[model samples]
Target: MTTAPVRSRWEEQRSFDELGRPLRDVTFCVVDLETTGGSVGDGDRITEIGAVKVRGGEVIGEFQTLVNPDTAIPAFIAVLTGITNGMVADAPPISSALPAFLEFARGSVLVAHNAGFDVGFLRHFAREQDLPWPDFEVVDTVKLARRVVTRDEAPNHKLSSLARVFRSGTTPNHRALADARATVDVLHGLMERLGSLGVHTLEELQTYSSKVAAAQRRKRHLADRLPHAPGVYLFCDDQSRVLYVGTSKDLRKRVRSYFTASETRSRIGEMVRLASSVTGIECATPLEAEVRELRLIAEHKPSYNRRSRFPEKVTFVKLTREPWPRLSLVKRVLDDDADYLGPFSSRSAAESCLAALHETFPIRQCSDKFGRHPSRSACVLAELGRCLSPCDGSVDSSTYAAVVRQLRDALLRHPDDVVELVNAKMAALAEQERFEEAGVHRDRLASFVRAAARTQRLTSLTRCPEVVATRRDDGGRWCVHVIRHGRLAAAGVIPSGVDARSYVEQLRVSAETVVPSIGPIPAATAEESERILRWLELPGIRLVEVDGEWTCPVRGAGRPHPSTATS
Candidate 1:
């Protein structure tokens, strides 16, 4: 059996030979319509239709027609359009006129001054006639003029004003045919001006004429080299320093959007302005793209990225490996055989989990390093019956060890004792009408339970030496992932007809080697591990193989605490 060649991590970027339908090869149908009134829904009807189809600066064909409204045309509209009801009384009705006009404009890009008014009427007519409207790409000359011509160049973007400005042979006098002919000249004039700015394709013309900033619109060429596939993209400055990193299901589409008006974020605008180029790494699946984006952001620490740059700064609640074990908040996890319950976002969160553990177990809360033969006095916590008081010799080492064992169980395997103890305290406070204090206990309990749950969820995958999973994506391609100690060791997409199991095994063999580190998330960052766990938990994920235990504790703090649910 011949196996498919393994795809490299970085595929050669596909060249965009033709950005999108070069303008010289495009056929444009410049259309104009005279209506009986302002709105089609207000009983208004089309009075006349005129369109000119042109390609390569030459007129190919023309369509002209007058439609009988079946209703009386208002006197003002008839005067404005110079088409009285008497003129169209013997003409064909819209049902006939619209079909002929649509046939003439078929397979051509539509252009009109104030396209909404003209296209809306046409769309309404099509709907009323139960005719399926062809998805035509429309270009509004009014919007295009706004982007290109300034007030000094043209007092107003009126059809007559622009016709005079562009030196059109025909003048717009509210007549459909003459106005459409005038618009054809104006389109060519605008295209000539845009040609110098590199707007040579139909897509580039559409993007250039949008409400985007000219600086951003000029940079649309940066996306021309990107592929239309799921991947990670980086915006870099002249020095090649990454300005921003992002993931997209379609790299070309997403990168092009940065230059369009839809991207409204101010910092993104600044980033785009400073970016000298765009680099894309095409991935086989969306999951791989997302993971690559996270890893890139962490590696580059791009200035414009607001998250995932400081994974090392995350705090962890550690069960210190000392003569008397106690929970301590630390920044780094070491090779010591002490249990850890976090990867909290803040030190306060780690402290909350530590406080909850101290409240439940009478373990030492002090940070003093104790020798084997310690001779020290207990603090005020001992007097309040809060501490086990091993320092004062009030509690034997064995008895205190038992309490530490239960605390370790709460942090690692079972947290029901912590949950129950905290809930009872909250209930007692609420019964005594001390609701405010109860709220405090409720918050701490919630923090502890959530941290415990997150720790267990990550550890369930991190402890496993290898795990392979697969899921069929919306495109019917199987997305396979090989995870080693909770890190994404390998990922690839298997085509629908191929054997997914065999491909997944091949991926596992070539997977990245990961040496398990010491904490709950041994091989990857907490956020990365969480993302992997979420993908694993998503519906339709089939576990192909597992090298070690891959399960969460049955009675662990993986479930929501009662206090958390209510609060």
Candidate 2:
């Protein structure tokens, strides 16, 4: 005959151990309390107690008791829990039985179906009887069940219902011990499900289990090898092709989160399942990591990554190179010498920018690819005074060129006049209660402001011959990057207790020639330039070098404060 497995004091005390301990090492007490009535406020009292002590998924001990409540058990509750009043009449009072139950459950994390009900009853009894309540880490099977099992898998998150789904060995019969037994089975099943999602530690299981699906948990192994550092991570499928790319200051934590329910993106679930491995490229700084992520997404065009995937499919609002030079939305930024405003996300946004410009400057709206001469006939825009009639040869070259210069100045240098005009239109429309039209005007102004700010920032960065900035990293080390023309040319780390000047000079000389090529004006895209600018604006970052002037308007559209200008 096999003797019962022994539990050492340390093994039993595993609940108080360091968090993230393996699930198999922690002790759990599955408990259930049968009460005479529905709620404690109604003077209900626990009639029976059932608890099963489990370790490593196997039941090693049990605790069952009956407590005389000093009140008659309600007939319906008596029939429901099948614990008659007579059965508990001769039992020990709660003051005596509560101590015994506490002793049996000590040094274990509590598990129960609808744990709040059981724990609440225990707390009430402990308070009345003047008994101390142990601070037990509780796990609710009901909560775990709702997360791990879907409605189709189980009709509802009830103990009896889940018992049927999991096919618990002991059928629940409204008896405390039997229902508690069923809960033990349910708890084990949920633990098994959680194990697949890399929830090896009790802390991870308790924190993430309710939010993670089984499929997501299954891919937790993919993130196991990632380092906890600032870096870019790539998820790859069986074919070793990149499926998704992302950046994180803590690579391990971020990549691991994708395999949990916390990652609510519909496509991410599929991405996690399809991914077989995760590859990490550590960076000295978060800026370098972000830049690397942008480059990787652009290069791989990963199926799961939505943003920064196809920077080429963006629209640019450009002034035509012809003598007429109407504002045109073009797909590609050619070598032609024309003022370009965009790199906008869509053609509609580019159109909004153009409309905002039109509110101030009367540039042509026609899509004509005109020669040195203009179109023979004036379009409807000319009739509406919307265009300067440049297409109809109504506006001369020098006259149109002056209008083009205004557009350029408003876009790049000073947008105060255009901003004032748009604000007046929005306020006037709002006063007339043409709310929808006002909304359109407001969006146009906002689009112009955002485009103007982005354009100005990008232009400033690209015009600089070279830029060097530094931020303090862990251990007081310095993370440095050398940017040239708004592109991340090179990056390096200056370890603590070392001279940074020599290393900085060396890194700058050997920096890579990564040209900016995404946006129309800059060699880089708006997104890339924005990333560099954001990094430079970080609190500890200091601009160490600048070959060209970088400036912003003191009272222009890009200013942070709202403009109070009139039409």
Worst 10 residues of 2 by lDDT: 1-10
User: Candidate 1: which stretches are off by over 4 Å?
Assistant: 1-145, 152-211, 371-375, 427-439, 565-567
Ten residues in sequence with the least summed lDDT for candidate 1: 1-10
Per-model lDDT: 0.85, 0.78
Q: Please provide, for model 1 over 1-567, each residue's C-alpha lDDT reduced to its tens digit, 9 standing for 90 to 100.
A: 112243532355443434457788899999999998899888899999999999999999999999998999899998888999899999999999988889899999999999999999999999999888987999888888887889998899998888888999998999899999999999999899888866677876776665577787778789877877788999999999999999998788789878854456888888999999999988777777888888899999999999999888888888888887777888887878878888898888888777888899988888888765667888999999889887877887788889988888888888999899999999999999999999888888888999989989888899999888889888666788888898888888786577766777778778888999786765988888888888999999999999999999888888655776534
After TM-score superposition, the amount by which residue 35's alpha carbon in candidate 2 deviates from its true location, in angstroms, is 16
Whole-model lDDT, candidate 1?
0.85
CA deviation > 4 Å runs, candidate 2 = 1-203, 211-218, 258-263, 367-377, 390-398, 515-520, 561-567
Q: How accurate is candidate 2 locally (lDDT)?
A: 0.78
